[model samples]
Target: MNRATLLTLGVTMLAPLGSAYAADDVKVVEKPIRVLAGIFSAASGANKQRTAIGVGYDFMKTAATNPTVYGVFLDYNSKKVAGVTTSLTGVGISGRFYLESANAAGKPYATLGVGSYTLKAGTSQSKIGGKLGIGYELNNGWLGELSSTMIQKIGGKDPGGVTFGIGYRF
Candidate 1:
């Protein structure tokens, strides 16, 4: 082979090795715990649309391509409806399945949870409920999500609503 051709072949063969070494030098740090605080806007169903404050804690390591996060959340809202003071509170444990790598710039996830919810309007009743949700998380530790919760029948009416939330993970 000519010197020029040999040099070209050598460079081409070495380029990938150089890139592989560079990739090995790049380390990805994983954060296993995330704390979140946000707002929840209840969807209209058995109750009027109301906004509530929510807090959550998630335990998941970002080293996996698809990580299942275990989390717990609490939400509370109080408002007057038809001249009656009403309050709703929910506490739940959830499992979130991530669609992509947690280290990805924008990751999508689906969640399922079960919990007990209490509604107080003149009287108070507690019911077992389930929730389903989808969320998008950004690389900067911010996330936006929407969920629907369905509580057991209370007074012949199912008290449940959709919730929207924005949170930060740290």
Candidate 2:
């Protein structure tokens, strides 16, 4: 090929490469408060599924390097045991690592938290445990999450359950 033709081809190919994307060009807004509400269910057994609706909130400082979340939540689990009504309530505080993608369209996160709870059977039983979950954070400040919680029982059984929920950041 001639040098003139080669030079023309190189310039055309390099022109597009000059327009590289920079993360600095994208604006990252920090939200002061994040609130979430969702439903939770625990896998007990046949005719024994614990259920609850919960609300959560997060207040923390944001860092460009590592996105973080700090929050607390409570759930009220009510079920029918032996044809009688029973209720279990739990509360916990957690911090999560929020990971944002390069495109900044969506964010993924993992969380770990610890707290105490109470169950009302024949008597009120108090227990302590930790919670874990993985979820997605949308650019629009909406989030979806799946979680597993484990709270030890008092003279009864293990009170661990799975939860799914949707939340928003403000």
Candidate 3:
């Protein structure tokens, strides 16, 4: 074969392979804000167990490797202490640190937050609180987490304890 003809054939044969590599290099663009909803089971300082519903939003565009999330939660139980029913409400802002790349499947993360918590019974009391948690997230946007929270004493009793939750990101 002539040299010019051989070079043309080689270039034509490799054209599709070069395009495939370019396609693989394309990166996925994610939405700036991700909304989430979930349910959590919590134990209070009084040793009462209650279930709660929570909702939150995550800021996807961050300088850090992980995302920052903000959340609001409410929980109540019929169990009365000293003949009084009690309920707790709170809002928190947390940051997640991923063990691996954010887009990896089955990724694990650690979270820390500070917030304000309120307790309501016959009267209402509010205090500052902090939370620490660990979680695992699937590539499909489902996550499970376990956390511990500590709220400053209200009327000489702590209002926070351990919580387990499941959430979905949208």
Q: For each of the candidates, give the backbone clash count.
A: 1, 0, 0
Ranking by lDDT: 1, 2, 3
Q: Residues 64-96, candidate 3, lDDT per residue (tens digit)?
A: 345333333333223357777666776755556
Cα lDDT of model 1 by residue, 33-143, tens digit? 444444444444334656666666763323346766665778676677678876778887666678998568999998776667898878999876766789998888888
TM-score of 1: 0.70
Question: What is the clash tally of candidate 3?
Answer: 0
Ranked by TM-score from best down, the candidates are 1, 2, 3
lDDT by candidate, in order shown? 0.66, 0.62, 0.57
Ranking 2 against 3 by lDDT, winner: 2
What is candidate 1's local distance difference test score?
0.66
Flag clash pairs in model 1.
43-162
Tell me each candidate's TM-score. 0.70, 0.67, 0.65
Between 1 and 3, whose lDDT is larger? 1
Identify the superior model by lDDT, candidate 1 or candidate 2: 1
Misplaced by over 4 Å in model 2 are 1-39, 45-47, 80-83, 101-103
Instruction: Report how far off residue 53 is in candidate 2 (Å).
Output: 2.1
| Error of model 2, residue 63, in angstroms | 1.1
- Candidate 2 residue 68 Cα shift, in angstroms, is 1.4
